[model samples]
Target: MPSVLEIRWIMRPASLLVVVAAACVGEPDSSPWSVADSAGVRVVEIAVEPVALPVYASVGELEFTVGSIDGTDGPAFGDVGEVRSLPGGDVLVTESRSQTVGVYDRSGRTLARMGGRGDGPGEFRFLHVAGVAGDTLWIWDPIPQRLTPLSRSGRVWPVVTFEHELADRPGDLRRLADGGFVARTRFQPLDPLDPKYAESKVWTDSLVLRRLDAEGLEIDTIAIAAAEQLLREIWPSPTGEGDGRPVGAMLPFGTQAHWAIDSIGNSVVVDGTSGQMVLRDVRGSIRTVVRFASPPRPLPEAEVERLRRSRLDDVESSPFRPMVERVFSKELLPTAFPRVGGLLVGESGTIWVAQYATFPEEVTEWTAFAPDGEPLGRLSLPARFQAREFGEAYVLGAHTDEFGVQRVQRYRLERP
Candidate 1:
């Protein structure tokens, strides 16, 4: 079967990859960290101190908020997609529901609203603030599929269109510190009769990571990792023989992997099994493998069943209910809890890895590592706050209240 792939090139020319030594370049420091070389790759194994680092004394002082129950002053945002701090105390917010970017002042006043629902240069069908590169604001729209650069004042620049080659959808477009872009596209067989899955009841779904220059041109393919291991239940064809329809579902709490690229285009891959983070440099070379003392926690069967039942209840009225039931009939709970829930790279090149929270009431604590793979400390955000960007002196994110009202808020970072 034929597949589609869309590739585009925009801003900046490709530069040379700065090569680091293929062997261990530094000696082990006095900390609980050790340095080693594994197959010519440097490894920094950090034995995180058992005594948990104290959480921040306080989250921070409230700076400003830019959403409300009524749209009188500012946007009564239905869904706030992204929030980033701008120079001189301004905030950039992407209101996805309205398909626009709203620039707000420090006092929660709307400065300017950019873009609306459209396919034109300044408009966006599915708008997201990809990242900020100096004075340029990157807006990503996977619907019409292009990257639009805008000034801090919301002035639109040349748009880079994703020209269709093969049919895979590219999304998660993020800007690297070197002024390039990284995106992810997933591949899985939708047709049961796909040649690769013809004789297999189990199919592997994979993720493709591609690097692009500032102009949206392909730089190099980074890595392809298994996104999911799906089990397919084949429904026979009209003749009741070959080429049956395959209905697939993943096992609950299965081990999965996630990745994030930092400012310098260095990538970190987090494997759910061990939770160890493998860091690769801009040239896609393994620079270090960051390990800590934390181990995977055991998940309780009761909680597992509760979650499984909750999932079933969600799809109870859907046509795929039977498939979901079949997927859950085998008690597919994981042996241990997932180690890393999510990962982020701060604006200052700090790697923030969110340790999986067991309960909804538990505040998620993130372990921070310096750009060089040294453990910095632990940081926590306000409960229910989704952090989208960080600054030298503040955290920029969205917080949804109990009334389901979303607000873009910034809090001052209190330094010791």
Candidate 2:
């Protein structure tokens, strides 16, 4: 197996991998990883370094060419759930509240709109933007269990309905360049000890992503990752020495493995347990493993208390006030920050790994990695936006405005 150190040239030009600091020349203070090779499968132990945090002030000033879509003239998005960039500087957005799809140009002007709340053809009850391939865009709704495609003009697609009787809940789904798709699914491992099925083992959850043909047939399962336990049931203790029942309380950030399929159908799987990811081919062979310099930070109990108290008004107003009271007690936080926050495979084959700062910051940071797993420094966005797709020279994502309206925006990413 070729080590990531040896695979750097295949994924990035030599200039991006040039050393800039002493930290990049030799092992920093200590070895950050432990490498082992067995049966040609290399497993490297990942430990985030304890170093000075990367500050936005050090990232220099940012310049953005902004484009936004809000409810002004044509179609104003009610709940902008997802956004994707198309080929011609165009964007597709899904409005969950309005249950509509809108197409916007680079200027963020709503050019075309389609679909509304209905059970009829080309309609959806609850919908989300899936992905765009060529001039066709796919929309998925779990309620209707349909994957419908639409033309660039927002017209109903001329092809057959995509089969979505999923064997697993979709973690992420994106259309592949070959009319196929790449998706990650969540699966629960059967616990032999728990026949009643009241309790769940955290390590039993797994994520599997597969490559599928355009006709909805599975081509290959490319990646499999172990998922962490979250939202476990806490029955009352017989000895009265435990917290109350936590009816599926969600974590602030997920520890489940996240992934993105590159333009050529390659899968980039980020491990939720470590600051690393394995880039693999469609055939499921490991091509390279990427790691970055990051340190793990424990969750601040004070912050947890603050957030819990901040929701007092909302909880008191909910109809299920009694249930809400038991959900987020003072003891509901994990010991450490989530291993990884988000992952994106850029159009240029640069992998973007989100920096999970415990507090709010000015610019969101992504530690970009070459496809061969070489660290290529960080890419900082001007705003705190959750980027969902990357175009040739832009980032497409949803950002909320001051009034709490989720709007889709695109910003140009000037890279070296």
Candidate 3:
């Protein structure tokens, strides 16, 4: 009988096999499965349908150009978490590794670096995310699990820490129209013996979206099981070792995934690994699955049987194994890519999606789309950029290496 490695090689398409083999560089059995070619790329040929409201043009382009923003010494600004725009055209950036939120002007010059890694009044143990509302800046520190509010003038207020049952780790915080803010909490791992095998086994677990009032009280919650199922269906399952145990089960993965809320409180949750996005209406009863991609084809029955009979050691050390891991790695896995990277819902119900692409040098680009899912233009930048919203402006938080020094750049959009 042929070995499991041989069977996997035979099942993979010729074109994909060559690509995988090249990536493996003579390594044994590294390739897993070939993803659908159509996955990850944008949907370009869908027919437009009429809705209750008018369908306006929803596509725009992003003309992003890199700028010089110097503040802080080398190694000061680390990996960026969130880039938020203030009311007066300034941008606030959370340096997760450096434990500081660097404030910058619209032109990319740093004005201030707020807070460090500490437990003091203004300090943050771990800065996970950030947002801006009027003159206030909200930073989420997961270690302390509190929201640290800072004034534009750099005065720190008493932290808003919620009860553990309300939210263990805060995801994203957005300002509401009613002077309150909405906070999102991710799903936690249930008891290992729980019957929900799939939820507990997956690295990126499902998430639960919760709305918080000004007093940090939980006002509402949205179950994301449907979204999780949808994403799993879209991405190929990691290789199952003997006894059919998935490799991802042992790896640490993020659970917050992606989330966004509109002016009317409608929420869109994205599970990139599953290629599924769930849109929940304000009433919560209205849930719709937005399918963006398809998973790789499964192995044939004969091939499956061959793999089952193959020796464990021979299979584990095969070149095809690395290929499988590479195909499923977040970088190459088509299902792991987000359909729309940075999503924002406008007050007028205009849904804007930033198509994000990241390259090896930390370069990133974002393409904008209208609320009706129309393609807008694209934004290209030289650094890593994450989307943030503040009132009418769209903020792009970026991290770049300038002559061996790390810097943060805030790019704000002036919508026409």
Which candidate tops TM-score? 1
What digit string (tens of lDDT, one per residue) describes model 3 on residues 199-303? Answer: 323434556666666676777775455223212211223564332332332121122256776644567665534434455555443344544323323324443
Cα lDDT tens digits, model 1, 181-255, are: 887776543666666665535555676677778666777777667766566766667687766776677766666
- Model 2, 1-416: lDDT tens per residue? 54333343465544434432334457554544344564565554444542322221123222222233444543455776667667766777777777888787765576788989998778888776667777877887666557788888878974345565556656456776667877667655443335343563233367788777888777777888876544445456557874434334334334667777765677778876566788787688996665544556777877666655655566778644543454455444466666566787766676777766543322277666556554555566656566776544567676666666555666666655
Find the candidate with the highest lDDT and give its number: 1
| lDDT for each candidate structure | 0.68, 0.61, 0.48
Higher-TM-score candidate of 2 and 3: 2
Per-residue lDDT of 127 in model 2: 77
Please give each candidate's TM-score: 0.77, 0.76, 0.57
User: Which stretch of 10 consecutive residues in model 3 shows the poorest summed lDDT?
Assistant: 45-54
- The residue pairs found clashing in candidate 2 are 71-76
